[model samples]
Target: MVDLMEHAGANPGRGTYGMAMAASRTVFEARRDCAALLGVKDPRDLFFVSGCTEACNLMLKGLLQPGDRVVVSSMEHNAVTRPLHVLSGRGVRVDFVTADTAGLVDAEAFERAVAEAPTRAIVCQHASNVTGTIQPIGDLADIAHAAGALMLVDGAQGAGHLDVDVAALDVDAYACSGHKALLGPQGIGVLYLRSGLDAMQLVEGGTGASGADEPGQPLDRPERYEAGTPNTPGIAGLGAAARYQSAHGAGIRATERRLTVRLREALSAMDDVVLLGPAPHDESVPVVSFTSPRAEPDRIAFELDRRFGIAVRSGLHCAPWAHRTIGTLDTGALRIGIGHGTTDADIDALLAGLDEVLA
Candidate 1:
C-alpha cells in the first residue's frame, strides 16, 4: 500500500516566502484523475472538497432554492440526509423514494416522486453503505430527467467499489469520498458537476485568481466552486491512489466477487442467516451483509472481533430507511464490507466464527 498521507504535508506552489502553492497543483491533478474515474468528460467540472460531507452539502445547498423539493432514496448516508434536514429547516422540502425488500430502490417509485411538481432534484446513494445494495442509477437517471429533475448521486460507496460513469448514468452532480474504497487519504474528496449546470456558491473566499478584481471569487469552472486553499498533500495522495486503483480495479473486483459469493452462499444456507441486497447479480461486487435470528448484529460483530479476530461494522449504517426496508432497522444487521485486500481465508474465518456463535 502506498501511504502518502502518513507522511508530513508537502507545501506546493510556494514562492520565496515558502507559501503553499504546490498544494494547489497537487489538488488540481487529483481532481483531474478523479474526474476521469467518474466518467466525466471535462476534468474542469471536478472540484475538491474537504470530504464527501462537504461535497454533498455543497451540491444540496447550492442546487436547491427555497421551497424547492428534493427527492432522495431511503438508503442515503447521513451526509445526504443531514444536509437535507438542515435545508428542510430553511423551508426546503424532501421526499423519500421507497426501496424494495432487497434494499434496492424501486425505479418506478423514484420516477413517481420526481414526476411530482416542484421536485427540483433527485438524490440517491450509488450503493447502500449498510446492505451494499447497488442502485440502478442509469434507470433512475432516466426517470429523474424525464420528470425534469437533476440526479445527484452520493458515490461514497460506489466510487471505489465499482465503475462510475456520471455521463452514462446521467447524474447531474455526484460526490465521492477518497478514503473508503478508493484507499486514498481522508480529508480529500471529489464532486463532479454536469456540464452547463451552474451550482450556486455556498461560500466565497480567495480562489488564487483574478487578484485584479475587488477580492470577489472567480466565476471560472472549478474556481467558482473551490474557495480558499486546497488540500495539496491529501490531494497528492489521492492522485496516487486513483492511479493505483485504476490499474488494479479489475483484479480487485474479481477477488471481491469470488469471496463475497462464496460467503453469501454459505451464509444464506445457514438456519438463522438472512443476506441482504440483490441475489448475486453477475456484475455485482462483494460487500455482503446478513442478519442472524440467534444473534444481534452488534453482538455478533463483537464476537467476531474479540474472539475470532474478524473485523466488521454493525449498526443502522447511517441508513435507517434501508434497514427498515429489510426489516432490520430496529436491531440493525452485520455489514461485512469486503475490500480488494480481503481474502478467501478471511471469509472462511468469518463463517467459522458465525457458526460457533450461532450454534
Candidate 2:
C-alpha cells in the first residue's frame, strides 16, 4: 500500500502513460480483490468511497425514493438512521424494529415490522457497534425476501470479524469500512451494490472515463456512483488488508473470541460492573461494553489511557439508538475492542489496569 502510494502517483483513467496505466491497474485490481472479500461476483458492482459513513449515505440516499417505506433496526448507527431521518422528512416512511435489552434484533420483530406489505427495503446493521451482538442477518434476509423488500446490511463492525459473504447473506447492498478490524489505512470504504439494482446516482461528476462521450455521468456500476478521483492509496491498502484476512480470517476470529471471553469474564466478576450485550461465553464479535455504578464511563476510559497507557472508547459510540436499546442512554458505557493485533497479554494488561483504576 505504501509502495503504491509512492509509485502509483499519476491519476487513473483516460490516460495511456506508464504511471497513469499503473495507477489505473492498481485501482482496478484493488476493486476486484476487495469485491471478493464481500463475495461479490462482479468487481464492478463494488464502489470505493471515503469511508463507511459515505458508503452508508450513498446506499440510503441513492436507493430509496419519496414513497418508499424502509424498515431499520433500533441498533443502527447514525450513518443509517440519520440518512433515513432526512429521507423521512422528504416522504420515505421509516419504521424501526426495536432491539431487546441485550441489543439483539430478532427476526420476529423484523417480520412484524415488514408485515404491512409493500415495504421497499429492510435496513439493519450486521452487528451492533456498541454491543458487538451479531444480528441474525441470514434470517432477516429471508424475511426481507419473503416480504419482497431489498435487504441492506451495514457491515461496518462485522466485515473483518465475520465471514461477510454478501451472496450467502443474500443482501441487496452492503457497506463496510476498510480500517478498524480490516487492518487497513483509514479514510477508505467499500460499498457493494448487487448488479441490476438501479439505485439513483447521488454523486455525479467526472468519472475519468467517457467524460467527453456523454454530457452526464456514465451509466455503469462504479463510475455511476463514484465521483471525481478516488482514494487510490487507501483503496490499495484496503485491498491488501482484505487479501490478508481472506488467508487467516478464521484463526484471527478464534483468537478474538478467546480474548473476548477473557475480558468479559473478568469484567463480570467485578462488583457493580454491568456488562452489556451477549453473555461472556455467547457468540459475538470481540467487543464488550460495560458500565459501573461506582464510576463514570468517561472517567474509566480517561484513567485507563492516562494512568495505564491503555486505550478504549466511552460514551454512546456514535450509536445513540444502541445505547438507548441497551439501557445505557444516560451513562453510556465503556467499550473494549479486541482486534487482530490484540493479544492475551494485552487483555491481561487491560484487566489489571481496570482493577487498579477501580481501586
Candidate 3:
C-alpha cells in the first residue's frame, strides 16, 4: 500500500495513460478480491466507497426517491436509520420492523411491515453491531421479493465473520465496512449491487475515462459509482485484508465465537449484570452487550479502560432503535466485541476486570 501511494505521489498525473492504466488495474483487482470475500461471482458487481456509512447513503439516497416507502429493521445502525430519517424528511416513508429483546427481528412483523405498504426496498442488517444478533437475512430477502421490494443488506458486522453469499441470500444490494469483520483498513468499504440494477451515482467527478468528457454519461458498473481520484492505497490494503480473510476466515470466526461464548457466560453469571441480545449459545456474531444494575455503562467502560487497561465500546453503539428493541433505551449497554485477534486470555482478563468493578 505504501509503495502504491509513493508511486502515485511521484507521478501526480492521474490522467496520464500510464498512471490511469496502473490505477485502473489496482482498483479492479481490489474490487475482485472484495467480491470474493462477499461470495460474489462477478467482480463488476462490487464497488469501493469511503465506508459502510457512505455506501448506505448511496443506496438509500441514490436508489429511492420521494414518496418511496422503505422498511428497515429496528436493529439497524445509524448508517441505515439516519439516512432513512433524512429521506423521510424528503417524502420517503420509512417504517421499522420490531425486534425482540434478543435483537432478533420478528419474521411475521417484518412480513407484515412489507405487506402493509408499497415498499420500494427492505433494508436490514446482516448482524447487529450492538447485540451481535444474526438476522435471518435469507428469509427476509424472500419476504422482500414476495413484496416486490429490493432487499438491501447492511453487512457491516457480518461480512468477514459470517458466510455471506450475495447470490444465495438473493439480495439486490449488500453494504459492508472494511474495518470491522474484514480486518481491513478503516477508510475502505464495499458495496455489492446485483447486476443490471440501475442506481443513481452519489458522487460525480473525473472517472479518468471517456465518460469524464461527457458529464452525465458515466462508465460501467464500478467506474459509474467511483468518482474522482481513487483511493489506491486504501483499496490495496483492503484487498490484502480480504485475501487474508479468504484464506483464514473460518479459523478466525471459530476463535471469535469461542471467546464470545466465554465472555457471555461470565457476564451472564454475574448477579448484577443483565445480558442483552441473544443467549450465549444462540446464532450470533462475537459481539456481546450487557449492562450492570449497579453501574452506568459509560462508567463501567471507563473503569475497564482506565483501571484494567481493557478497551470496550459502550453506550448505544449508534443504534438507538436496537437499544429500544433490547429494552435498554434509557440505559444503554456496554458492548464487548470479540474480534479475530481476541484470545481466551483476553476474555479472562475482561472477566476478572468485570468481577472487580461489579463487586
**Steric overlap count per candidate:** 6, 0, 0
**1-359 per-residue lDDT for model 2 (tens digits):** 77876777778885879888888998898898888877999999999988889889889998999999999999999999899999999999998889999899989988988997589999999988899999999999999999889999898998998888999999999999989787778999989999999888778888887655688778877888888888888888888888898888889999999999888888889987899999999889988999988799999999999998899999999999999898999999999999988998898888888888887
Against the true structure, what is each candidate's TM-score?
Answer: 0.92, 0.98, 0.96
TM-score ranking of the models: 2, 3, 1
What is the lDDT, from 0 to 100, of the residue 155 in candidate 3? Answer: 90
Error (Å) of candidate 2 at residue 201 is 1.7
Error of 1 at 313 (Å): 1.0
Error (Å) of candidate 3 at residue 215 is 2.6
Model 2 steric clash pairs: none
TM-score result, candidate 2: 0.98
Better of 2 and 3 by lDDT: 2
The residue-by-residue lDDT of candidate 3 on 14-110, one tens digit each, is 5556755666667778788888878888998898899999988888888899989998899999999988999999999998888888999977788
Cα RMSD of all models vs. native, in order, equals 2.5, 1.1, 1.7
TM-score: model 1 vs. ground truth: 0.92
User: Per-residue lDDT for 97-191 in model 1, tens only?
Assistant: 87877778888887777777667888998988877788888888888787788889898988888877888888999998989888888998988
Return the top candidate by lDDT: 2
Relative to the unseen true structure, what is the Cα RMSD of model 3? 1.7
Best by TM-score: 2
All candidates' lDDT scores?
A: 0.81, 0.89, 0.86
lDDT of 1 at 235: 81
Runs in model 1 deviating more than 4 A are: 1-22, 281-283
